[model samples]
Target chain A: MDPSEVDVPPLKDLTIDNITDNVKLINSQCPDPRLKYLLERLVQHVHDFARETRLSHNEWLAAIQFLTAVGQICTDVRQEFILLSDILGLSLLVDSIDHPKPADSTEGTVLGPFHTHDAHSEPNGTQIAHDPDGEPCLVLCTIKDRSGKPVSDVKIDIWETDSKGKYDVQYEGREQPDQRAVMHSDEEGKFWFKAIVPVPYPIPHDGPVGKLLKLLKRHCYRPSHMHFMFEKEGFDHLITALYLRGDPYETSDAVFGVKESLLIDLGTVNAEQAKTYGVKEGTKTIVYDFVLVSEEDSRKLREAKAMAAMKHLGLRMKLYNGLPVPEID
Target chain B: MDPSEVDVPPLKDLTIDNITDNVKLINSQCPDPRLKYLLERLVQHVHDFARETRLSHNEWLAAIQFLTAVGQICTDVRQEFILLSDILGLSLLVDSIDHPKPADSTEGTVLGPFHTHDAHSEPNGTQIAHDPDGEPCLVLCTIKDRSGKPVSDVKIDIWETDSKGKYDVQYEGREQPDQRAVMHSDEEGKFWFKAIVPVPYPIPHDGPVGKLLKLLKRHCYRPSHMHFMFEKEGFDHLITALYLRGDPYETSDAVFGVKESLLIDLGTVNAEQAKTYGVKEGTKTIVYDFVLVSEEDSRKLREAKAMAAMKHLGLRMKLYNGLPVPEID
Candidate 1:
């Protein structure tokens, strides 16, 4: 815009001591209060981080280049930034903040970068393992609400890695989904599917995020788990994973995605139970119940949690002439 | 490496309340103590920002996509990240932190993204205006140290915008540089050059950074200024600019680079003075001195300033068992 068209306050001589305030003041004209608030808080925290760390010029440049590399490496299927966020535990943190559920409801976790929408819908008890690379496992699951009412017709997108510790998308020239499918729960809120036992595998570490992990002396592996994304009318969209017991990386999942409530045990199905599940005797099996919360309840819980956090942080709920400076002890 | 080969402390089921600590714990194994400290501080500040603002899932996704676009748009000639830093006031902040000058020394500012290494070396007093697009201006300057000692042979790379508020680099299919050149201070520490009067110009606004500025209700124009970068043996590399007083955007420079000390008035050179500067009569003139600090002095000052900031922020000087958590009041 032409300089004359800009509405600016009398700007103070920007110094280290006042630059943050100056930026906030200039940006106060944003029409969206929420955006203005977010920008203000963002500037405050980032500036504080720089000041507190006494970030050197070289270090700052390195960070810029690092982020650039992270961004440049992203492709249609690979999202290095999400991987970076996952390794830093931000993805899970955001999920937890957005999806706080009741004690009985299933907990949420990181939705890693491999999920795809092209999985073909299949019948219950149909085997999703097209590669035949891992031991067959029967997954028997029930979906219900907190009040123990069956929630039928919940569309569940299930995916997992093969015994080779890789998803179908990770392989070159992959044309169709393997060990992944879309299924629906019956009127009884029950669903059964056959899949290969997933194995622990390292996240894609050949890019900048991988280099960072190496520098931090960290492994990039995530624990073996089955990804489940549920979509149903009147229910909160659920993105979660069920981690298997005794996986090598179970306790040290690189993405910090493991939660005690989300961990389930793997068992061998007896002859009678195998017949009922429509699987062979002695097949590996997983049995777990997914307790979902209603969309209204989820939204209310999130708002309450957000308010409590704001209070804990001493933030105001309403806008004022200027935002109160967050105290830095 | 195998999971068993990876060294880990006892694992705890990660919860929102404990995730930050767990991430730090896992990353504490980093061999480099400084990197470890920086990472810890970065995680703390970012996580705090997310929590305090109750950053929504949509907001987080938006941020990720914005950053990715910023990175993807960078090229050999364009540094969108540095531009991002400039608009955010981080570029100037880093300059201030790294180059803390004394009262008598020339203050430093942003080394904006338009600088190039291909500037042709030109004789003193040579006119660099290849295009007859703007009014002529003569720049007369001397290089000196803090003690008023003349510092000779200082290589100065000078650049500025045309009256149209655009740099040569901004033009499509540009060839040789114009309105920019590399000159050197003589034995008397004096140098003069004839160039066009730079006009206030908007930073590139067709990209994501531009979109952000528009969102913040900010004008992307930086006040009229001439960029100067100096390099000399035994002296600090100085990157600074001289802003014209009374420019409409002087106080609201998009990059926050307008320091009080860096503002200079434009005057008309009389016939006699124009002859000395080898410019036509009534040419606009800018008279300013460049004061530089020695390499040793600059390093000492930066180190002391960093030490003090660390102390003020409650950071430790030496490595400890673990970094002290920064207080967030």
Candidate 2:
């Protein structure tokens, strides 16, 4: 589209007070209402931030250079941007906003940058732990609907760090997927596997995001948690994790992925009980049940949440609702 | 620093409502009071932006990817981040905040990304134009202190685009600088040069920032302007540009660099006038004067501005001022 043909009024002599308004005026030409609204609010917040902070040229340039370094460091195996977001708490915030769940439903958390598509598919009783340094554990879980009915054939993907707090992907080479597996629930909505207990780990801190954490004087350690993803034909796809109770970093998780409801206690089993669960006598065990929300139910809840969010944003929408679409040829 | 060593409170079950506060709490460990304040405010604004916009997971990922691309595209000679800042009005906003001027003093504008340190140094009245396709023009300029006294020996750097709106640096494999020169003011506080007439041109639009502009329906053209930088002992270094009057984009400069007081008009010169100015008969002419402020004066104004800006930000500082700094061993 030609600029001269834009419907925005001519803007002249933009000072600090007026520049934001002029910017909004020009960007208001965007044909998509949602994008236009997003840009308008984004500009307002950033401009207000600059004004309120009295951000100096040097400081602003420092931010620019920092962000540039963060982008430059990103590779296929490493996503420095997502790590940056995770550290900033934006990743969790977005997860909460996008996937609001019912009180009884299993809570969702950050899908973090480490999840990959290459995990081995296995039966429920298969052992996923291959690291000698890790202690063995048995995971027994049941998948159920909101009304507590069994939901069979649910695809459950589980991954975790070893005793030393490293995932399989973190290793440079010499690895079939260890400490991670994908399995299907039985007819009674049951799934069980043997793996290493997860340990608290620090996020990748050798990049620009790490530098920022150091400057902020914050640690980059996430509490020990097992990653889980659930998919079924009629249920809302779930991306979540289970945090271990009594972990030292639980209260101060770097990514803010910890939830009280998601916390579970690890139990030790006697020889007979361990044999029945199919793990060694010294192995740790956890028995947990996950509740899923149906697609129709998820849609209804999302519509309600979206309505509330729209009301919160109604003022800006109302202001632009009257804007005339420029006559375009 | 170890997470256990930090004196921040234990944050548990961080919901969307409390994630921002938790982030600030963690970041409050910053020893530097000013940096702590900046991070606190930055987190507040960004988190607020995300919440207020109801930013979705996919949208957030898009933003992350866009920023990564912008950072990845930057090189030693080209700064895509600065370009992004420029088009967003952030560069100009920083310039205005950092360099406040008295009413009689010349205003400062954004130092755009096209500037280079490799311009040829030349004597007064030397023709800097090398492009045969460009129209010849004589630029006469005088520099003075705010008191109207000639300020001799001022370092003046001037650069402008050719008639086609392309800078020398934009061309690949160019050996010599065209229409750009670095010169000093004479004892009489006078300097002159010959260059091609600048034309309104689109900013580099083949990059991520350009894609953003296109998405926002904003035209990427900046008004025709001549870039200038002036520096001398005891005076505030000035980075500014002159916008030609009546340019189609003058009112809507892409970088928001146009100010009413900085607008200039082009004049036609006769054969005798051209000969006196050491230019051809049909040459265009621009005669302008620049005023500079003393360093001491600049400091005073800056202090005043800083105080005002602080008052604008006083609420946040006040909230944090009483915050107890956690005792650390």
Candidate 3:
């Protein structure tokens, strides 16, 4: 239909008082209902943010320039936008909201920018460290269902930075898939791999996200931890990390990915204990167990979590009923 | 101080319950107190927006991708980010906040992307329309101060689209400028020029902003209006528009630029009146008077406005004492 032929609603003068209505009118023509809703909510938030801050035109222009720089800096190998989200603590917040685990199941964290599909599958207990300049470490883990039954034949993807606190991808001329491997749980739901102990590392700070962090006077380091992703046929996929206990950054992870339950002790092993894992003396060992929720249980948990969030938000809205709330038809 | 040498505060795991604290920690290092405050406020609003919408990871990714595209599409002549801001009503909001007018002074609208500094100066009453296909229009205006005193020798930069509803820049292989000129008010603060009545025009929508507008199902037409920028020493610069009263999009400008006070009547002129202005009969004529504010008065108004905003925001914060309020120090 011709928009001009139909009676279009009069556009309100763009003022702080009518910003919400103007946004709604502009978005009224959205063909997709979901997109319309999202746009409407986004518009209201953006307008409110400006009003709350009494944002200046210069500040608005600065934001535009910063975002433009972020886009210009992005390439196939780099995603500055995602990095911005990570540093803003948004990545972790989205992860928590999307992956609400049952009491017995492993809690999820951010699927950081480093994970890749090209990681080669390696046998259980295979050595993952290539240039072993750091302390030798052995990682052992098991996967079990919420009912306490061993979940065999599960894929576990493990990755971490090298001893010097640099991912292989960060090197200029490094080979693909360094310090990363995909391992499957054996018949007993057991998996193990050899690698250097992970260390706190700064995220790539040479780009716009890094510049923003510096301007904000915030550090750019993620805590010492090993990223893990577990998947099986009838269970919810879990992406998590095992943060090393006592690591300085463990308490202040830049991405806010750490959880108390996810922290594990990194114990020093004697020669005899090291020999059992076919490693030299003074090697470090970390053992962790992950519980997976069944798909049905996960769905139920998500529903309950969403309902709770709605109730919570509803209560909060009552406290500020005078504030404009976007109509969501 | 070396961040590594000094004992740093422990990082808290990112959670909904601790989002406010996490934001504070991230901004702890900001050297500029004002920037620190802005960042903290920005972080709170962003997190709250996500929670209010229950924004999903997929939705967040989509936003990241969209912003990246907007940045990527920008060039020397094209600014997709600004267009996005205009469509979302942010440009107008920012303009309104920054250019608050007194009761007697003219109000400002959006400084659209089409504005250029390359317009050449012409004598008062000079005809701006080089090619005469459009209906002839005669613009007559006078400039005065808030005290009703004539303010002469002011530079009046005027621009509008032609009969075909396209700017010179929009036409491929066109001249440097068309239908745009800078005129000086006479000793009596009177100015007049000859041009065509501007027709409604669409904003450049072939780019990312246009694509977004299409997705949102909103039309992209701006109402017929003539842009004016008045400048003189010791006076606050005025940027405004004289919108035609009966234009179809006058009530619903795509950029939300229309104000009732800015609208002017376009009346038909008789042969005798046309001869007086040295124009043909049946020409359209528009007469308007603009009021300027002194720079000192503008400064005082801004100070008062800022103080009022601070007081208002303080009161609002009291209503949400339970919510996270960024620490000022």
- Give me the candidate number with maximum DockQ: 1
Ranking by DockQ: 1, 2, 3
How much RMSD separates candidate 2 from the native structure? 4.2
Candidate 2: list runs displaced more than 4 Å.
Answer: A171-178, A269-278, A309-329, B174-178, B270-273, B309-329
lDDT of 2 by residue, B84-118 (tens): 98888888887887677899999999898888899
Docking class of 2: medium
Candidate with top TM-score is: 1
Clashes of 3: 4
Write one digit per residue (lDDT tens) for candidate 3, span A121-227.
99987998887587788887888998899899999889898988887777777667889999999999889889888888888888888888777766788889899
Better of 2 and 3 by TM-score: 2
Model 3, B189-273: lDDT tens digits are: 8999998887888888887788887777678888899899989998877789989888988877778889888988898778887
Of the native A-B interface contacts, what share survives in model 2? Answer: 0.69
**What lDDT score is found at residue A157 in candidate 1?**
94
Separately for all candidates shown, the number of backbone clashes (residues 3 or more apart, or on different chains) is 1, 0, 4
B208-317: candidate 1 lDDT, tens digit per residue: 89999998889998889999999998998899999999988888888999988889999899989966766678788899998999988987787777767778766667
Q: Give per-model TM-scores.
A: 0.94, 0.91, 0.86
